[model samples]
Target: MTTSSRLADTPLAGELIRGALEIESTGRGLLPHRLPAWARAQCADGQLHMAESQPSGVRLVFRTRATVVELDTIPTKRVYAGAPPRPDGVYELLVDGRPAGRGSVPGGDTLHLDAATGTAARRPGPAGTLRFGGLPDRMKDVEVWLPHDETTELVALRADAHVEPAPEPDRPVWLHHGSSISHGSNATVPTGIWPARAARLGGVELVNLGFGGGALLDPFTARTIRDTAADLISVKIGVNLVNADLMRSRAFGPAVHGFLDTIRDGHPTTPLLVVSPLYCPIHEDTPGPAAFDLEALAAGEVRFTATGKPDERASGKLTLNVIREELARLVARRAADDPNLHHLDGRRLYGEDDFAELPLPDGLHLDAAAHRRVGERFAALALTGAGPLAARGRRRV
Candidate 1:
């Protein structure tokens, strides 16, 4: 395999970027997790544990000019043993604020999940390497965005030239939490996720807490957001709750209140916006445990279908419709005293009309083009003039 020669052969453990929490040192290299040790200790669910290790916004930032770059990593890639094969997660490389390269590693450890049984098996595998050559001969700022979906443990960073940490940009930090949509389930690349895209367009830094299948109104998640330092904060709710069938209308409302209450405990006056879920057609009027559309899979694509009956709503089961209504009411009630708190209908970002134009390819999560549209709309709708984010900037800074 090609490797950097001019740069020292030894791995640079001391020279890592600052986006991750604590980097766990391993015999092989470094594992970057979004969750700190304390927060991780509170959850027993395997899904949440796995999601925390995905490193949604983590990256390696530095300056180098070796004309060749190599990043070695061992990613815990998820695989459905019987389901269709998934594409390898991608890493994004940016040089001097310009797109430099994009590619995926060849192989890594795999978690083979059984679609029918809801069980998984860990299969050990070898580390894979990604290399980029022909970089400009002069030193420039470089950022290597980690994969959004896979659990990546960075093994080594090598470039033929010297590297140093890039200077911190004077930009607002946005801490956001949501479900799989925000976790970038269908996004094409790491930075291609809507939150990442929105952060770039809004000229802000991002701390994404978009846990896939794991944004289930967990108190620990709220506490994590409370502890993180950020200038702007948002929480996107609904789809995950409804789709997982994890809670009912009665519980979801109070759960949300408690979640926001914890965040407010830490960020008393931070401009906090509560966003509802995106336009997911299956769960809009119907309740869920959304099931895989086997028919679609048989037809050679993946999609989701709602399984809960509409009558289940009478028992307080949540649907996207119920969630939006409750969220609006809850926010309005709280906003009477909490002027810093605001609400945005998730549909506003991706509405019915938009769905008519560009349906969610999987019947649930937004596809690549949809991600771009939602991200651009979010920047315009939530970060522009008179928006809550803008208003906060005026008040705080």
Candidate 2:
């Protein structure tokens, strides 16, 4: 069949393959579905909702095609106070509404899955790809499930298909990096990650370089961004650097400058946004080595407390305020020569308002509601030309 004819025939062609299912927790109340696509045509309304009232926790199911495909789950690496302790269990992957694979995420580890084996397994970071080699060529749906777990938070779900290729020329590619929050922490699905959600919302393709706990101004990552092919780009930094105490003020400024320099070496004129950290109370003004509260973890609980006092400078921590100030200064200096460069305070996406309403359970990563808020703000800022940054080729540099 002609490509155009095939496109006419497959109504769901180029549509996202996976979506979220509402899972309930007695302790957490009704959990929201993650990454609901902005394209109404691509979404199935009320598809995933609270189904039962079991005390053990809520049992939720996703709706999707039946073709058997590989499934993988990414886990949270950084644990802090009030953070949900990683849960261990036999998580399930259901394809076309049937159990196609089963896997186990050992307690205190991230889980990965594939069709060859259904159960969840520990993965290195909040990123993994699932390959589904032998499936009906004209598949229609897909779904994934996480069994009851007190600690596990579904980050993302990705599926590979053998359908006709996407029209690459029609879409711009977005390259992004950030902390665990950007790496899909607390997000329910792979595409639910804020970057992914924003990309889908903006009708762009995405090359997600978000590495959980790996956004520390690494030269290699900067180089990777410099070399990658992207029509548009952005980097979400600061929070991770501050939270991890990876660098102090002296090194932070240089590192930020260098990272931007590397990216500019390739796409000198691409609209590049430098996003600072989102809202986190404990780290808002304190410095870090944001250590996990072992006491809470050992007790199978999550908590976040002030690690450094306001008057204490001996600890040499970088707070959100510090990062934000530095980032603004850096961008101001760079924008003088690089008009394409822009800076955005992460709170513009998830700010004190959100923190007040849907406070992060761990005081670090955003919860599902906060994720939606961030996604919406990002779409408005990055896509709609609503923020200070302009869209497409409007940059002078």
Query: Which is the leading candidate under TM-score?
Result: 1
Find the candidate with the highest lDDT and give its number: 1
Q: TM-scores for all candidates?
A: 0.95, 0.63
Error in Å for residue 289 of model 1: 1.1
> Candidate 2's residue-wise lDDT over 133-218, tens digit each?
34444544343333322234333333333433222235566666666677566765444457656865776655555555667786
**Candidate 2 RMSD to the correct structure:** 13.6
Clashes of 1: 0
Candidate 1 lDDT by residue in tens digits, 1-397: 4564565543556355556766877777788878888888988878888888898878888877667788888988788744678888899899987889998987789998877887889987888889888889997888889999888888877777787777777778888889888888888998889988888888777888888888888888888888888888889988989889998877888899999999998899888999988888888889999989988878778888999999999999999999999999999999999998999999999999999998888898888888889888888877766778763442221
lDDT of 1: 0.84
